[model samples]
Target: MAADTAKVDPMHQFAIEPLFGSDWTFAGHNIAFTNSALWMLIAGICLWIFMIGGMKREVVPGRWQMAVETMTGFIDDLLEANMGKEGRKYVPYVFTLFMFILFANLLGLIPLPLAMAGVHAFTFTSHFTVTGVLAIMTFAIVLTVGFWKHGLHFFSLFVPHGTPPLMIPLIFVIELISFLFRPFSLGLRLFVAMMSGHVLLEVLSSFVIDAANAGPGYGVLIGGPSFILMIAICALELLVAGIQAYVFALLTSLYINDAEHLH
Candidate 1:
């Protein structure tokens, strides 16, 4: 029972551990190198390697070049559809954001590398702090672009174009409140999604282990079903990973569109 209890801590996977000694600090603050930071570095390195493949500029596109170009073109089309011609300038930011999240999410589902090292892979996106920062960064860009492009006129976004004069005030209040919730919602959506999926996987896996330890009969019943369900969830998680990344970039482009052409 105690051993089973230890294996079932789903939240433990999200805990950040300092790779360096715990005593490492800066200016009386604990700034030790952490597992989350290390994973981010790994994701960045992987992205760099993947992206450099397209830079060779081969006259005939190879597998790597074609794959990279397809992803780039996909983002370009998404932004253009959302924001029109002006969206071209944003391709780099949106593409990077999409790829980074995709890589992080996908890597988190693959624990083999870390398992070999006797540790689980860290998924930074599971932390609200990381996702919140990303959401705020996107929100900041929207604000900067809105005010920069349209000046004080950007405030008109709170009032819909066809709103009646009398309804304008009421609608404005609601819209402004909704606008303020963007960052929180964006951060929360990603954090909760990543965290929930992991927790579910962990709990189900514990059940499988407990059943197996009980006896062969229990293992054939509870353990088999649990193991099968884990496999299915793992496959579903891969789809969710890509979808979440695309949703983040899509909403970002849409928000930027609102800023660029306020209606």
Candidate 2:
């Protein structure tokens, strides 16, 4: 009984099980809809409703409208601060990325039951693949914009402006490696943060449940404090979700700036 109680599988929460009756594969790929896909779809739809459905020109904006406006203004300021006037052209893409990520992170925090019977929640951002793809997309945009604006001169990004002739080769190698690692770094930061936080919550929750089942004395002594800590962690995770989204967007904008200006 004690052994069973200690078998808290916090990592089980991250499993990507098929949503339908069974797993389906088409051609050579397992493209069956999973909890991750479902949560992504949910996040996308929620963002659409919050941003597009609320766009009514009113003297006094409704709550939804105000929320939409606030988000728009915040992104606008972020872009302007990072990328200057040229940032306006990329607003649609950057804003969409920001909103999708923000919604995805927030949606993951919601305890929604999956179509699969056992799973209770899905955190799309906690998956490295999801964040990796997003980071790659951002990197691709930076490269495309840089080459389009500056042609082969975009290669100058890897070369520092003021370098001793002998040190130029070494600096280029170092800078090139740093530039190439951006996507991995960006993706890993978000993935690790989300996954670790959720795992911690799951572990704490399991302890609380175990303590509650033990006895009233154990519940008051252990479960109560565990529950309170879980709540505090959940609040911190909420803030972390927002901060990670903002950081991702901000870094993308800064990368765009580097690409455009080429320091």
Clashing residue pairs in all predictions, respectively, total 0, 0
**Clash tally for model 1:** 0
Off by over 4 Å in 1: 1-6, 21-28, 113-117
lDDT of 1 by residue, 1-263 (tens): 75555466768889898898689778999878898988898899999999999998999999999999999999999999999999999999999999999999988888565563558888999999999999999999999999999999999999987899999989999999999999999888988888898888889988888888888999899999999999999999999899988999998999989999997
In terms of TM-score, how similar is model 2 to the real structure? Answer: 0.92
Model 2, 44-157: lDDT tens per residue? 888877877456978799888888888888888888888788888878878898889888888888765562466576888999999999999999988998899899999889
TM-score per candidate? 0.95, 0.92
On lDDT, the leading prediction is 1
Q: Please report the TM-score between candidate 1 and the true structure.
A: 0.95
C-alpha displacement of 122 in model 1, angstroms? 0.7
Report lDDT per candidate. 0.90, 0.87
